[model samples]
Target: MKYLAAYLLLTAGGKANPTDADIKSLLSSVGVEAEDERVSALVASLKEKNIDEVIAEGKEKLASVPTGGAAAAGGAAAGGAAGAEEAKEEAKEEEKEESDEDMGFGLFD
Candidate 1:
């Protein structure tokens, strides 16, 4: 069931309603087998009119869950900032070493 939901969300791709056959085919391709009755029930429960709606609703629900957009964005920003800071520090160290060498601070000196 969870797999079915994920499949719908994945293939929806910003559409509103995906047909029952489309859902069934996707599930079948992914090795999720079920009787026609069950499949029908599942499709009926989806209540989606098009892929866009499914995607939108799925995104909304996902946003409501933990570790959603804000957390992900914050983590990414923090990671990028940290990486940039490290690179800057390394460059500063390199510049300092170059300056020292230029001033005759080396093994020969």
Candidate 2:
């Protein structure tokens, strides 16, 4: 399921569609121990659907999922805040290090 989700996102983000063999490999890689019939049926269903329409529908569905929407926004916000803090800390550390170096505090003392 995770692989499927990732594949969908990747495809939606302009990556190429998975080939039949690629789909089979993905299923096997994900340890889906279903019969070949089940896998074939899934593939058939996917094939019957319009790729662009399916991707649009998935985006809409994801937008409606409270957890999914919230998690995405939360992750972005958290990442932005963390990145800003890290940059600030790095700048401060560099300034402190530069000041210490300017004082000639070294092994030669």
Candidate 3:
């Protein structure tokens, strides 16, 4: 990820093709150590590609991914049912308590 970020940063800075040495230098400037193998791999992968087009392709691929909203909604529905039961029991307890204290006097009062 760091290697990718460095490559992207150089590309954004008008370096049409950032070399491995450039990536390492940029990382060192920010107190980060760039791994040579990873830097080389990233540079090679992006060497002949347009960064903008690559990013657009990645976005399209990511858009097709499932975000688990359906699973979360189902879990929430199940939890809501259990919560409703607990609320009903609490309501019954409150009703009994209220009946015994109709004069509206509380411990703090």
Candidate 4:
């Protein structure tokens, strides 16, 4: 993930084709030692690919993923007023439990 982030940062900064050494230097500047195998692999894979096109393709693929929430909402809508009331009750119960937990303090507190 760090390698990919560094690559994207370099590309965004006008480095059309960042080399493994460039990635290493960027990582090292922030106290991270770049692994040769990972850097080389990333560079080799992206060397021949257009970064913009690759990102566009990734976005296209991500668009097809199911978010899961929509279907549940659709089903609830189909169930009429009963489902709406149940949903409201569930939400209120959840809020009450959350507020009561740790005397209104979050987990870290």
Candidate 5:
């Protein structure tokens, strides 16, 4: 991830295609030690690709992904019975507390 960030920083700074040295230098400038293997891998993976196009493609792919509660809440809200069960449990707990208080037992006693 650090390697990727350095690469993007160089690209944003007008280095259309950042080299391994450039990535390592940029990372070192901010007190980060760059791993040679990871830097090389990142450069190789992004060789000959346009960053802007890649980001645009990523955005398009993400746009189709579900990012709302509907999909996540489907299973939890199934049968619509959780609310009733939760209410019953809450009532039982309240009754237990009231009975305990009615016993007139104090911690100091």
Candidate 6:
């Protein structure tokens, strides 16, 4: 993930294609040790690919992912129901407390 982040940073900075050494240098600058095997593999895999095209493909793939707005609405409904129940319980408790009071039978009465 770190390697990929560094590669993307370099690519975003107009490197177009960042070498393994470039990735290593960036990681090392942040006191991270780069794994040569992973770096080489990453370099090999992306060597023939255009960064822009890859990002576009990734975006297209991500477009089909569900945001679950319906699930969120259901959660909100559940939360609201819970809140209403709490309010009712509080109102009941208040009523009980009032009934336990003097109930208009004061000293002057």
- Identify the candidate with maximal lDDT: 4
The local distance difference test score of model 4 is: 0.92
TM-score per model over all chains: 0.34, 0.33, 0.67, 0.65, 0.72, 0.59
The TM-score ranking, best first, is 5, 3, 4, 6, 1, 2
Instruction: Please give the distance, in angstroms, between residue 89's alpha carbon in candidate 4 and its true position after superposition.
Output: 9.8
Please report, as a residue range, the 10-residue window in candidate 1 with the lowest summed lDDT. 10-19
Prediction RMSDs, each to the true structure: 9.9, 9.8, 6.2, 6.1, 4.7, 9.1
Off by over 4 Å in 4: 71-109
* Predicted structure 1: lDDT: 0.68
Show where candidate 3 strays beyond 4 Å. 74-109
**Candidate 5 clashing pairs?**
none
Q: Candidate 1: which pairs clash?
A: 14-52, 15-51, 15-52, 16-50, 16-51, 16-52, 16-53, 17-49, 17-50, 17-51
Candidate 2 lDDT over residue span 1-109, tens digit each: 5445645754676656654455566656768544556555555667646677987998999887686777878877889978778889999999787675766686455
Off by over 4 Å in 1: 48-109
lDDT of 1 by residue, 22-69 (tens): 666667787876467765676677664555676699899987788677
lDDT of each: 0.68, 0.66, 0.89, 0.92, 0.88, 0.89
For residues 1-109, what per-residue lDDT tens digits would candidate 3 score against the true structure? 8888888999999999899999999999999988888888888989889999999999999999979998788877888978778889999999887673777677666
Clashes of each: 10, 0, 0, 0, 0, 0
Q: Write the per-residue lDDT of candidate 6 for residues 1-109, one digit (tens) a residue.
A: 9999999999998898899999999999999999999999999989979988988998999998878987888877889978778889999999887673566664454
lDDT of 6: 0.89
lDDT of 4 by residue, 61-95 (tens): 99999888899888877898998899899999998
User: Distance from true position, residue 42, model 3, in Å?
Assistant: 0.7
The model with the greater TM-score, 1 or 2, is 1
